[model samples]
Target: MSWNIFEKLKTVFMKVTQILVKLFKKTNKSTSLTPVSNVIATPTAHYEGVQTATIIAIPTNIAKAVVNCCLKNRIDLAEAIFRGFGYGNTKIVVTEKEIIAETSSGIVLLDPSKYRLSEL
Candidate 1:
């Protein structure tokens, strides 16, 4: 039994050695490995002191509409400044940046900047 086991192991060792030798020869015949490139890329445009500035513009269309509505109603612009506020809703607040309208359900915020004319 010992002789049979030793013979089996010796055959397996010889087969493994042959396979390793074949793989080593195949790899040895290949070319030397190298990098693809070493180029350091850079942008052509330079922004040294560039700063972002946002200018909030007035809504000319809304202003025009308000003026027309006041003209039609024959009321002063100061008195009819909030002519379009509070019908189905509760409190409505208008400012330079946004309009806050409070309803029975929730509060709505409308940005006046988005309503401005395209040229502005």
Candidate 2:
């Protein structure tokens, strides 16, 4: 029993570490030597903020997708999480009318609130 608990903690820690690494990786570009792009396709502020929410602005869309995947696999998404390094602080949660994917990308939409805390 203790061993199982320890393993779970270890997995969670590793996942958190990997997420942090991805979120704050060191860039090797030196401004003096590197070239800047003229087409500013990406907005830096937004990228540092809500990236996941930007990917799928309409929550219903991602919810539908997650629901479809769950139905096809016959898996209880609330109980089964993809233990992946790319995920964030929590786990993916799915319900009949809502979806929470904070663990997957640091994106959260709680009731009337919608935003991401990936920068921390």
Candidate 3:
């Protein structure tokens, strides 16, 4: 029995697709760069004579990575990563929101009061 040319081509294509999928998944998927044990909350600044709430803005990717690491390691790595990035003292944090409300002027509607922090 002889295999046709189409069969050979199909087999090659399937192998190539499998390789590409594995490579892409390994590269795109999150992995812990620095070990979670080394992370710590280093204070950046202290506001004097005023009441303030610290809002740490972290990269979405990094935040997701931290969550993944924590889940795997069962440690609170997210807070450590946030503090390590110098978010110990600041207000008006920034992040990408999935549900966005925009007007004609392209202004993002971010009403913090609408969403209670305690619930989050």
Identify the candidate with maximal TM-score.
2
Q: Is candidate 1 or candidate 2 better by lDDT?
A: 2
lDDT of 3 by residue, 8-96 (tens): 32343334434444654788742322122222243332223222224332222233332333334444322332322222231221222
**TM-score per candidate:** 0.25, 0.27, 0.22
**Which pairs clash (backbone N, Cα, C closer than 3 Å) in model 1?**
none
lDDT for 102 (candidate 1): 29
- Which tens-of-lDDT digit does each residue in 71-110 have in candidate 2? 4455443433332212333233444333444321234433
The 0-to-1 C-alpha lDDT of every candidate, in the order given, reads: 0.32, 0.34, 0.30
Q: Candidate 1: where are CA atoms >4 Å away?
A: 1-91, 118-120
Candidate 2 colliding pairs? 88-103
Q: Lowest summed-lDDT stretch of 10 residues in model 2?
A: 111-120
Write down the TM-score for model 2: 0.27
Between the candidate structures 2 and 3, which one is better when assessed by TM-score?
2
Residues 1-120 of candidate 1 have per-residue lDDT tens digits of 234433343343334434544654788732221111222132111112321111112122223333333334444433322333322222223444443332222333345455444432
In Å, residue 65's CA in model 2 sits off its true spot by 0.7
